[model samples]
Target: MRPRSVRARATLGATAVVATALGAASFALLGILDGNLVRGAQADAERQALATAATAAGGGLEPVLVPGRGIDFLQVVDARGRVLAATPNLSGSPALTPTRPGKPGTVRDTWKRGPVRGGQRHRVVQVTTVTGGGLVTVYAGTSLRQADTADETLKAVLAVVVPLLVLTVALVTWRVTGWALRPVEAIRAEVAEISERDLHRRVPVPRSQDEVARLAVTVNATLDRLEAAGIRQRRFIADASHELRSPITVLRTQLEVARAHPDPALWGELVSGALEDTVRLQDLASDLLLLARLDTSEPPPDTPVDLAGLLREEVRARRGGPVPVEPDLAGEATVRGSTLWLSRLVANLLDNAQRHAERRVVLSLRVDRGRGTAVVEVRDDGPGIPAADRERVFERFTRLDDARSRDEGGTGLGLAIARDIATRLGGTLDALDAPRGARLRATLPLAAD
Candidate 1:
């Protein structure tokens, strides 16, 4: 699964996204924080100016103002910019920030270092009114010290908090990613422990139905196949040992007998028998070698082949034996496969049929265009195969009758080799029922356009 890469990419992407979002949000918060603080102070100054203008409109404008709650300075002035009323602290002072608009609306400005108590900074607002005594204006202001202090305090707090939040998110992302990849690590470690000698061992599968769990399952399936192949290999080795020993023992015994007797007349007879056994051993070795090649080698390139022509050639080779062979050669049916191996498959089937036939054997080749396959049928008028043992006959080294002599029984690899070759060519060989005997039918794919 290469879980480290998955984890690294996931953590990096998540951290980058969160960092960008939090950074943007932090900047927006800082910009809004100062303005929000200033808005409150300006709103207070506007309200106080409105109140002073209303008082002057009611015609009882006084120079000395009463104590108020919010504003630090308050003054009422006429249209010509003359101070008509003032706060107690500025009883005789000029209008605060009176250089405002000349209409009956509000004008807001910043009160710089001015003639107020100690010249403190303030947010100033001017409100003008349409009165019978001409246009009158009121000026009111509030200190900026508190709003400025709070804005600075919040900026300092956020400078510390944003980094902490991003760090916390990154830590959480790393831990969660590691947790998700833990199962993959476990699967890798377990598979690493599996050797050829440890083929019986299996990797642990997780309960979750996620990608990692599926990966674990696929690895387990591959291990199962390897284990099964190992078992079959060991079994073949055991069977090969037993089969090889039999002929070698017979050859050794015949030689030993001839050596002890030293009979010139018996020499011919003993030599012939020894030659027959040697041939049998040779054929057995050849069959074993062919089977080994089939098992281990990569598939040979498939070329166009004439199945009917190949069948006729094989039938001709097997003629003049004890059994009279009949050929039913149909029209040309082309298929695609390795010529040597396909010929081996046909020869094996014919050999098997001739050995089992009583008096008659029929070899036929037909092509079924509807099914896109070429079929080869070899029927023998002998004891037919039982339905229960049909599939078992194709297994290597399996003989239905163990007591039968080796000559009649053959090497027990003909049908097995035939089936293996058929399978390698993407075809099937099956023992089917016949009228009076057994029929081995091989179906292979027809060469297409």
Candidate 2:
């Protein structure tokens, strides 16, 4: 069942249980009331019967005893069960009850009494006393019809009212529950209408700051993130296609020229150009794949690697002319990271520095044992990057200078990859401001000794 429907049924069920309990309590109270009325009738009859017995013992029953105060019958009998005196209603009849002596104030149930037969039940009280030098018994009885009629009336009233009360309570509970969940139903409807393509749409928020409103806020926030991811994915695809098309077009054009000219020198030039474009294409495809893997790949295993030694080795392998590599690696600087990734990070930094340096590229590595960090810096003396462009330099396919195009041996992904790897390795890489040129610094946690 739906949530609101289940809530409605639960509310109805609880109200029904309460109504049933109240009905049962009311029924029990009625029973107590009916019993008390019958007891009061019996007490009055006993009092009247005792007075008649006293009268017969001292004087005569006909002058002292009176009837018809809610009592049905009265009789006096001697020890041999012969009627001595009785009210007019019980005239010429035998003893209504046995003349045997019983407890002083005991009431008994009798079915047949003093010519009144047909098994009609009556409440009787008996009193015994000495009269005319012999023992005599007095009985007073009353019909049970009035008390029984009252109990039946109460029962009938309860039977009608209890069900009506239960039904009314159940209906009221159902209506209240439905009213409470109306906002939740509205939120569900609004969210249901939103498709994947309509992630920009938000669920309607209620005015109250309850859980339902909070839920609407959370859902809308999730939609916002999904929309941003969608936009980024579309832009990434377009940029990748644009980057790939350039190399492929160049390769096709070079091959076509070689086919049409058929000159030996021109063939050599064409082959070199084609090979360079092929290498560029392969590198771009590899960078894109690595980025995709970085997005989903688990963190690499950590191991101790000498950061200073890695920097020194990358600097020594430099290919360009007139760019002197100066190293200021002070001591053993080791950090916890994957060796392959650390090597790539240093190579990317050195390559970027060598490309921009006029005549000198400086590499520095040091470990601050007090701070528990290893710092590596690559500085060059070429045109410095502006402060506004530092952060953008780490974004994919971003380049500040249009003159320094892809043909200038820069893929525009080296810094982005380096930053991503450093982050995964629990480190940070940033472009720091320098006096004359650019400085890129990487900080990583030092390995435990």
Candidate 3:
């Protein structure tokens, strides 16, 4: 079977419930009206019958009582049970005895006479009267046709009214349901119009604090985040292009110069210069790729790593001369991250410190307080970064003018890559002010069990 639409199903359900309740109420009302009509008609018939009986009683006893057609049946009996008078179409002696003189009685009964085809069914009202020393019993009954007609009329009215009311209810329900869902439809249309280029655009928030308005607020907040991310992505791309273009241009120019001169002595120097540019380009490209991958990849694999062990190995591998070193592995200092990325992150911070420090670089790994985080601090005796340029130093391709000519062999991406890796590993890197030089702190989330 084809699935029903929500509107149809909802409307149908409402209609069914309302129609059933209304139908039941209608049936009950019609029954009550029919009963009341029947009772009123019977009372009217009884009053008319009593009036006819009274008229006959005022006349002579020998005179015959004749009721008009369609009004009632009339009969009179003496004390001996003899039928003294009756209407023309009625026959046979009266079955009931005459009532006592000076006394009155009333009763109801069904009277049937003659063959089935010619017979008539009636509801009779017997009125007894005392007359002449004996008794006379008079019967006057009205037909039930009027009461039946009233009942049928009530039924007809119900047949028309019930359907009309149901139709009205259905139409009203459909319109009201549609009106209630109008806001949702508007929200959907507005959301469809939004795209990446138009992340600044937002869904209209209603003034009301209803659920739809809350949903709009939430969607707008998400769009705000997306817009910020897009801006960052654009800035990153622009910065990457500017960083790559300079080295590439220099390499190309040096190669062109060597080609034009064709001198072996200068050729080697030009090739070396080109090779240096190529290495710089390669480092820049690799860092950019790593940053991109880290931004898109899953959460880093969290494994327990000994911060002190990793630091010892990195310090030993450093080509730069280290004046003095101290290792203080306190509280086990275990953290969670991909060991390879975490090692590179620490190695970068150490390398940066090693390049800048004049005499000594102190490494520390320890956990303080109840929090399960490993802190790796690399403090040096060299000149520290200026407080104003601390944050800028972590940005890609951002090297201080003085450090630009320093023989650090860095592509200026080490700190940027370190920060990216730290962020991905649920950690952070910051340059702290120290007595002699800068103290770089790298904090990573500790491994659980």
CA lDDT, every model vs. true structure: 0.83, 0.80, 0.73
- What are the per-residue Cα lDDT tens digits for candidate 1 across 201-259? 88888898899889988999999999999998898888888888987898899899999
Q: Which parts of model 3 are misplaced by more than 4 Å? A: 1-180, 297-299, 319-326, 381-394, 400-407, 431-437
Error of 2 at 104 (Å): 15
User: What tens-digit string does per-residue lDDT give for candidate 2 at 14-71?
Assistant: 7869787987798787879877876877887788888887887896667224575878
Error in Å for residue 231 of model 3: 2.0
- Clashing residue pairs, backbone N/CA/C < 3 A, model 1: none
User: Which is the leading candidate under lDDT?
Assistant: 1
Alpha carbon deviation, residue 430, candidate 1 (Å): 2.8
Which sections of candidate 1 miss by over 4 Å? 1-10, 24-162, 433-436
Q: Candidate 1 versus the native: TM-score?
A: 0.70
lDDT rank order = 1, 2, 3
The worst-scoring run of ten residues by lDDT in candidate 2 lies at: 110-119
